[model samples]
Target: MPDVAEVRRRTWVPGRPVDVLATLGPLRRGAHDPTWRVDPDGTLWRGVRTPEGPATLRLSSRPALGEVAASAWGPGATWLLDSLPALLGAGDDVSGFVPRHPRVVAAGRMFSGWRVPRTGLVVEALVPTVLEQKVTGQEAYSAWRRLVRRHGEPAPGAEGRLWVAPAAVTWGRIPSWAWLQAGVDGARSATVVRSVRAAGRLEECVDLDRVSARRRLRAVPGVGVWT
Candidate 1:
């Protein structure tokens, strides 16, 4: 692991309030997910596999400073810093979304700081989503934890035992016996392998329109409306 002196750092001030928790919380697979963690002091840590390489990112919101402080380490440090704004919901456009219902209005007001984050890593998102198909939350999370901890790499600068998810090629290479041992069925495991094999096409969905992206994803054998 690199020392703090070798860390790359950045600060981002969004035009609107950003709820760092709400934005990134959905990405956590479970309380024990090896890819995500929350420190006692409320700092958020994430281990991710960027196109460049693996990285460990630490984020802290400084409301008084009206900015988010971020530090990253590993070969992917620069990529993580460059994508910080989008990962914090800077790309979310809610200007035209009108809430007419009373409950909707109240909910919006209550979660005003919340925005959808875009990590732009298709294989990272898809493998987990496939694992969750038609399974209980407990079952899905267990499978995810098992597979990642077993196959993934230890995050570069993580304070604890956080891990970076396996790359697309790694996901494709996981054997059937390993998948079954992780509690994943043949169908779901096949879907994951097939998706990772075509990871290049799937990743391009990030730049496509919603309709086109759905079409491209649905073209895969096991992917459907729910996936």
Candidate 2:
């Protein structure tokens, strides 16, 4: 088995101390499993469950690396931290959103990892949306895994196939036969193909506020309120 330290080196950060050692706790859930788990302490930990055991990539260490991960994941997390004190400070009651989503609200005991990615949002979120135009989620996720494993890059940390979702350019170039191998049909494939051509346009949604982002996302060729 490889050293956990070696695996740790590949935590996928951009090399900035502030990002690596965030002021608050890790908010990225499932960072330690196939799903990234964000700890209450704000430690964004990503783990690769090896045959030997679990190899963890913790963010609270090595300030420089953490900073990079922070930025690469999108530097908006810093902004979230700044507003957190005001939102949860003295006399600030947040029960409205808490009771609605008890699990998330209660578990969210920190002020980091809230900012969603901009480009990857378009890339990763679009995976299911593109493949699910007229099919089931199982079919879409399955297709995502198949195609990513085939055409996507290797995940920074993991034993099995953790996909680095193909970029827009790559998506635009994927052949139709590849889609079939992943169980995706022509109609859905066409939508993904068309959208990939306008990757920049989809990424533009990231800068907009949540409401506007969703609004513009819906305008994308294959994306919709239901999709």
Candidate 3:
């Protein structure tokens, strides 16, 4: 694995490599090595080894101003570390945190170092969230991998992660036929299209309290609890 400290030491533009980690957390979720890579332009990368075979990560951080927010989720401590900053309010007190589940707590301690991590926030989450509504995890993720791998740019560093997601302006330009090919039905496609227009405002939710942030996100025409 590459050196994590070395990657973190580089300077970055507002919207690329630095922010991808800021928003997505570790791309491998709860792997032992737990590494992420960033292309100079901000596209993110990671590697995984499942029982079936090895895998790699590549995606555009697609960050917007104020979009560097992340959320706690999944079955392990990893997400908590990455998303806690947003759930409890950025830079919150972890002293009172006590997990009800023993394993999750143990996992939390294991990954505690990233409590304030950056998960590319903004359009990164926004794009996926828009695709997830009223659909199974399978559907949304399938669409994301397809569209991004096809239309998104390539990663830009020594590492080989996928490129970042398209810009809002670029998202809007994705033709309808492209979404169909990616297996996104019309409704989910529409949400993504509209979200591209409101990318900036949507990311601002990261700055608000979790309740307020989620509520505000729901205010978007197509955004709801499912998103």
Candidate whose lDDT is highest: 1
RMSD of each: 1.9, 10.4, 12.4
Once model 2 is optimally superposed onto the true structure by TM-score, how far is the C-alpha of residue 12 displaced, in angstroms? 16
Ranking by lDDT: 1, 3, 2
**Candidate 1 clash pair list:** none
Model 2 clash number: 24
Off by over 4 Å in 2: 1-120, 157-161
**Model-by-model lDDT, in order?**
0.90, 0.48, 0.53
Tens digits of per-residue lDDT, candidate 2, 1-227, equal 44322422223333222333233222221222132445576555432222123333344444433532221111223332222232122223334544447666665545333322222245445655667667765665567656755775543444443334566777888898888887988878887877777667776775678898787776766677776
lDDT of 2 at 216: 72
How do the predictions measure up, each by TM-score?
0.95, 0.52, 0.57
Q: Report the C-alpha displacement of residue 156, candidate 1, in angstroms.
A: 0.7
> CA lDDT of 210 in candidate 3?
84
Report how far off residue 104 is in candidate 2 (Å). Answer: 12
